[model samples]
Structure formats: structure tokens, C-alpha cells
Target: MSLFKRAAVSEFASNASVVFSTLIIIWLSIVLVRLLGEAANGTIGADVVLGLTGLTTIAALPTVLAAAVFIGVLTTVSRSYRESEMVVWFTSGLSLLSWIRPALRIAVPAAIVVGLLTIFASPWSHRQIQEYRARFELRSAISQVTTGEFLELEHGARVILVEANENDPEKLGQVFVRIKDDPWHSVVVSDHAKTEVAPNGDRFLVLEEGMRYDLTPGGLVTRLWDFDEFAVRLDSKDAEQTLRQSREHALLNHKGRPTGLLLTDGKSHSDGQLMWRLAIPIATINLALLAIPMGAVNPRAGRSFDMLVAGLIALLYFNLINLSHSWINNQTLPFGVGVWLVHLVFLSLTVFLFWHRVRVRAPKNPSD
Candidate 1:
């Protein structure tokens, strides 16, 4: 390649790397905070938080790649103009079209990475996320119990509280339990509670030195039982089976389904998902094209105005992509119409800007 093309490509790649790194760090920080919150709320396991965060970052890669490529093109080209390098290129018989070659070099690799992410890696990561959540929810209720927290299980039919753990976290101390059903209320207090998993995989919370009090609705009498040990099964067999079925059904959710499945399926949500994946690569190139013209700043005035316009355009395009996906998914717009409209519009704008920059800016004949 020519030295000029080589230098341009080098600058574009460097800028993309810097922008990509910054965006990833910011995005990962936000995702980690949210995942930690989920772990703390007992919605997910603390042990799986890092794994989930990594998967989330993978799922977010395509958008980050697209924006980085966009900004990289914009910044590199704007810097060239600001430094009068474009003037040098123009004086040497090079036109705005010469920028396309270097931009394409960067865009092609970026788009390929985006295609891999959106087509294969992203869907897989999303499935992992779903499985993590499903398993976390399906774990035996006793396993989710933490010291000094009130936990409700069996659809709020029973509540368990552990005031402290004496020897080990697995062995609870000063426990309180409450059970409420149709016409009865039961409360139990124990000196300590420990969990035992039976040979059949059934889990029981065994309370030691506990007294149980049972009160029936509209009855003046209450029954009390005092025992050295008490055992209660944590979850019914039916609930486990139901949870398995729900998780199986979740595979059909948009995030859980693979890109290949989404491509073949005719459902609106699936089509929207598949289209959005395909759109990323195309939009990446189109945005790079848009930025070339946007990067052409009036050397007299500050280049900030040009940068402001580019930022607005990039933001507007990003939001439109999302809005179009929602509209297509909800059947408010036809799939083909909704998916391609934003890209086509921006691509057309890019073409017009390039034409104006190349033709209108050319020196006119003195006679004319």
C-alpha cells in the first residue's frame, strides 16, 4: 500500500483501540455494579457474578465496536483536517474519495468482529446468562439462606430467619420460622437450625430444641408442640418439576435463542433480533462513511461545531436503531421496512455529503 494509506490505516486502528478500551471499561463497570446488586438481592449467586459480568460484556461488544469504529473514523479524519493534512492530500490531486480506502480497511475488520459477536458469541453469552439466572432461582431454598436475613420460600407460604451462625454458616443459631396457609398460622422458634440433604436429594431444615405453635382461624384454642428436634422439607417435588419446565420454556426467549434459530424463525421478536444483528455490520460501515464528510471542518472556524454535529448524528442514529427494533418487534412496522430504513437513510446522507464535498467544493471556472 502507499505510505499515505498506511499512515491513515495506522491512525484509524490506534484511535479505534483507544476508544474501544475506554468504552469497554465504562460499560463493564456499569454491568458489574448491576450484577453485584443482583447477587446481593439473592437473585443470583455471588460466586457466578464475575462469570455473568463477563458474558454481559461479550453481549455488549457489538455496540461498542460499532461506536468505536464510528468515533475512530471521525476523530482520525477531523484531526487530519485540523492539521491541514487534507489540504496537502487535496493539493496532491487526492480527493475526499481517497479517504474511503483507509476507512474501509478499518471498517472491514471491525464489521467482521461485530458479525462474529452478534451472530455467534452474543447469543451464546445471553443463553449462559439465562441459564445462570434459571439455576440460581431453581436452587433449593435452604441454599439461598444467609445469616441475619429473612427468607421466604414456597411462594411466601413459609418464612425462615436465622439470627446468627455459631460454628459454621451451614449451622444456624437462634432461628425463627413462620408458615401461613389457608386457615392456619404456624410459628416455630429454635435454638439452632441445620440443613440436611436426604439420600433422595430432598432437603430439610432441621430445627433443634424448638417449640411450634399452631393457631387456626376463628378458633380460640392453639396447639403447641415441644420437641428436641424438628424437620421440614424445603420444597415440594412438584415445584422443582415446574421450575424445570419454566426454564425449558425460557430457551425460546429472544436472548436465549441462537442466531441461527432466530434467522429461520418467523416470529416478530425473533426477526427483530436477527435483523438487529445483521444491521450492526452494515451500520458500522455507513457510520464510518458519514463521519468522513462530518470530519471536513471549516479550517477558519473552530472544528468543535463539526464535532458537535457528528456526535449528534451518531447519537441520533444509535437511538433510531433501537427504536426501529422495538417497532419491528412489536409489529408496528414491517420487518424489512423497519430494519433497513435507518441505515439506508444514513447511507444516503453519507453519499450526498461526499458528493457535495468533492463537487461543490471544486474550483469553478472564472468565466462561469
Candidate 2:
């Protein structure tokens, strides 16, 4: 490789590393905070926060790496222009268009990695995340209860307290349950309690030798009853339904579905998802090449102006990709047309910028 190519590729790699590292840190921070909030609210368990954070990061890497490559190319090229390196290259018979070769050297490999990540790794990560949540959902509420602590269920609508039975490890002693049913409040005290699973998969809390009291809100009415065995049904049906919905939603969710499955699926939403996955690699290459021409600026001009324009262009390119996905999903745009339209537009712009920059650098005729 030539010195120029070597230096440019090395510098692009370094800049991308820095940017990728920074972006990953920011992404992890955001995911952690959100997961922690969910844990606190009992939406998810604290134990799975780190696992979900890791999986979430994996799922987001393709977009993050695309942004990194775009910024890295822009920074490397703009710095070259800013520091007068472009003048040296120009004097040596290297036109602005020559940057494309080195830019692609970095971009092509990065795009391949992004492609693999988006197509395979991302979906796997999303699947893992979904499984984590599904397993948590499938856990019975009674399984989370401790012997000595008061466990509240249904947002404190029902409160239960129990003691451990030394004779029977699986049984609970001195069980107390308080239920608030709006107009009526009931309390139950039992000598011992245990869980029973019916043949149909429903769970019940079986309280032995219990006394129950029902009280009215105004204290005008009271009822008492004694029982040898009291059974409280727990809704296994609701849990089963939740588990079913989660699986269905996962199939419906494009991000969680594998690329192979997506290809086989005939749904328009799946096609939109497939387009998005395919577009990431293409966008990575386009944005990297586009940065070359966008980064050409007058050395004497304000540095921020060129950077601002480049940022806006990158933003627009990504937004258009998202818009294309939306259009395909909504059936407003055909998949074939939507997939390449935005990319072709930016590619043409890239070609135009290269031509315009080369023309501006061309020497004038002595007669004109």
C-alpha cells in the first residue's frame, strides 16, 4: 500500500475506534438506567438487568458502528483539508476523487461487519432479550414470596405474611392473608398453608384450619367463618395467556425475527424489516464515501460550518432510510423501489460533490 493510503486507513480506523467506544459507553449508560428503572418498578427483576443491557447493546451495534464510520471519515478528511494536507496531495496530482479508494478500504470491511451484525447478531440478541422477559413473566407470584417478609400482590390489593414450617420445609406456618375488595375487606388466619397445582395447571394456596373474618367499610357489618381447609385460586390462565402473547408478539416483532425467517415470511412488515437490515450496510458505505466530498472546505472558513452541514446530511440520510421502512410497512411504497431510492439519491449527491470540488480546483484558462 502507498504511504497516503496506509496513513488514511490507519487514521480512519483510529477515529472510528474512538467514536465507537464513546457511543457504546453512552448506549450502555442509557440502557442501564432504563433497565434499573424497570427493575425498581417490578417490571423486570434486578438480576437480569446486566444481561438485558448486554443484549440490548449487541442489538444496537450496527447503527452505532454506522454512525462511527461516517463521523470517522468526515473527521479524517476534514482534518486533512483543515491542515493543508489536501494542498500537498493536490500538488502531487491527486484529485479529491482519489479519497474514495482509501475511504472504501475502511468502509467496506466495516460495512461487512455491520451487515453480519444486523442480519444475525442483532436478531439473536433481541431474541435473548425477549426470552429473558418471558421467563420472568412465567414465574409464579408465590414463587417470589419469602417466608418472613410480607409480600404484596396486585399493587397491594392483597397482602400475605407467613412463617416457615420447621417440620415441613415446603409448608408455611402461621399464614395470614388480608384482601381489600373495595366495599368489603377480608382477613384469613391459618395454622399452616401449602401450594397445590391442579390437573388443569391452576395453582391454589391451600390454608389448613383457618378462621376468616369479613368486615364492612362503615363497621356496621361483620361476618366470621371457620374452615378445615380454605383454597384460594391463583390465575395460571392469565400467566399462560401472557406467555402466549409474548411469543406471538416476538413473531410479529421484526427486530426479534431472524433474517432467514424474515425472507420466508410474506408479510409487508417483514419485508420492511428485511429492507432495514439490508440498508444498514449500504448506508455505511454511502455515508463514508459521501463524507469525502462533504469534508472539503476552505481552510480559512469557519470549521463548524462544514461540520454542521455534514452532520445534517448524515442525519437526513438515516431519517430517509427510516422513512422508507415506514412507507414499505404502510404499503405506500413498493419494497423494490423503497430499498434503493434513498441510497441512490445520496450516491448521486456524492458524485456531484466530487465533480464540483474537482472543477473548483481545476486551473483556469489563461484566455478566459
Candidate 3:
């Protein structure tokens, strides 16, 4: 509420916004590059790529926000020292702890946003990603076959090539197929081939006037047969219709399941997921606290030192959280302990740093 506090908050917010935007753009750029490659390979569609990237960005927002807040506070405080702003404030009886009030003012709202993203938005995004992948995989088998190119299907069980026939997309004037099943290796070549859909909608590639050759994997003898009609299974409509279960059974659901459901779920994995969702928001707050002291830099030493330290601390904090999550899932660490211990450690560190900064003597003023 005071003029100094207002000015400090405004300064911190501005710096945080710039840092956050820069980091997000950089992160998104890397993700987009990878996603584009996958799309081109037919692993995913353009729409699905966009959806996945957008959701991943939402999932990553908390960490980005925490980093931004840390850098923002660090820049603001470090600059204050460099420009003698802190000297004026110190002369007026303000202490380092005075920074917390303004930092918290910015951080509290950020923490709320992180909570919503982790608990609500992230889960929904994950579900959408899973659904998109499921649909893509089911349709991928048939969509992969291209004219004038040899196609490997069913883990290389069959290889087929269609040559020529511009008038018909599903018809080929010349067709060759090799089916390798270890003991019995069969090769089929046909003068003409066409695709047909049964009433049940299953697809089959029908070959006309084709000759088949079969040879055992390690046999000197080979068998040959002449056939007028040969049918090869083209696509499994049934497989496409059967929905696969999603990999995302985490406590957070797109529809926003109550935290209690996650806590009480019988599955240990769910408990681990639940804890992760809850921990993200708490981590945001702790990171904010940690930032206050981590950002305290001596202007003479340069602005980069505090930023480097902040980056290291952030990296360590997130790594510890990941390790704790694994431990909880494995039952090596109790859910109660693993979930909160990492947070408590960082929180204690923050408190100690805050105390140290406040108690330490300010740099002695130079004789004017």
C-alpha cells in the first residue's frame, strides 16, 4: 500500500512478464519443431500437433511462471542495489523482508493460476492428447499405404507395392506382395489388383491371376501355386472402432475431479499423480519465497550471478520433486513424506535466506 511497496511491485511485475514471455516463446519453439516433424511422418495430424503443444504449454506454465517470478524479483532487487535505490530505502529504515510483501502480492495470483493449470487444465489437456493419439493410431495402418511405394505393414509381416493406375486410387495394374512368417515365406505377384470393402466394412486387397511362391526359411525345396483370386486383409475396421484405454488415469481429469477422489483412490499410481498435482501449486509458492532471497544480488558482483544461482536452484528443486514422485510411486518413500519433504526443504531454505538477508549488515556507504 505504501508508495515504495507499490513502486517495487510494479517493477517486479513488469520484469516477471518479460522473463516469462521470453521463456515460454523459447520453450514453445522447441516443442513446435519436434511436433512438426512428427506431423510430417504421419505420426500425428496438424490439428493434433497444435492441440498437444498448446496443452503441453499449459502443463509447463507453472514452472515457467516460477522461473519468471524468480528472475523478476532478482532483477528488481539487484538493480535497486546497483542504482542506490536500496541505499535510500535502507536509510529510511526499510529491510529486505519488506520485499516479501510486494513479492507475495505478485506471487499469490500466480500461485492461483498455477493451481488451476495443474489441477484442472493440465489433466484435461492430457486427456485430449491421449484421445488424439488413440484415434491417430487406429487410422494410421491403412492411411500409411501409398501408391508407387513399397509399404511395410503389421510389424513387417507383409510388404506390398502397387505400380501404375492413375484412374483408380484403389486399383493397381501390377501388384507384388511378400509375407514373411519364418517357416513359411510366401511371395505373390499379380497382373492386376483391386480393393473391396465387405458389408461389414472390412477392407481386402483382391489380386487377379496371381502366382504364389512359398519357401521354408531353411529348406532347399520351394512350392509354387497359381491362383485366380487372392485376398489380403487391407484394413481392420473393427480395430479402428475398438477404443483403447487412455494412459492418463491421473487424479486430474478434464472435467475436474475433486481432490478427495485422487487422495482416496486405491491405486498407488493415482496417489502419486494426485500428490504431483497438489505439489505443483505448493511448489509455486515455495519457489516464490525462494526467489526473494535467491534474487538478492550485490550490484558490484554483477546481475548475472543471482540469475545463475536462481536457475541452478530451480533445476534442483524440480529434479528433487521428480525423484520424490518416483519414490512415492515405488513405495520407497511414504506418500506422506515424499510429497511434502522436498517442499519443506526448499521452504526452510527460503526462510533461512530471508533471515540471513535481513540480519546481515548492508554494504557500508562510501564517503561522499
Ranking by lDDT: 2, 1, 3
Give lDDT tens digits, candidate 2, residues 5-80: 8988999999999999999999999999999999876778889999999999999999999999999999998899
Those runs of model 1 whose alpha carbons end farther than 4 Å from true positions after fitting are: 167-170, 236-247, 361-368
- In terms of lDDT, model 1 sits at 0.86
In terms of TM-score, which candidate is strongest?
Answer: 1
Model 1 Cα lDDT, one tens digit per residue, 175-289: 8999997688999999898888777667788999999999997899798999899987786445467566656665687866788778788899998888788888888898888
Supply candidate 1's per-residue lDDT for 103: 96
Against the reference, the lDDT scores of all candidates come to 0.86, 0.89, 0.79
Give per-residue CA lDDT, model 3, range 23-65, as digits (tens): 9999999999999998877778767788889878887887788
Q: In model 3, which regions exceed 4 Å deviation?
A: 146-149, 163-174, 180-186, 190-199, 206-231, 239-241, 247-261, 360-368
Q: What is the Cα root-mean-square deviation between model 3 and the actual structure?
A: 4.3
Error of 1 at 338 (Å): 2.5
Predicted structure with the largest lDDT when compared to the true one: 2
Clashes of each: 0, 0, 0
Sort by TM-score, best first: what order?
1, 3, 2
Off by over 4 Å in 2: 142-185, 189-210, 214-223, 226-245, 360-368
The stretch of ten residues in a row with the least summed lDDT in candidate 2 is: 232-241
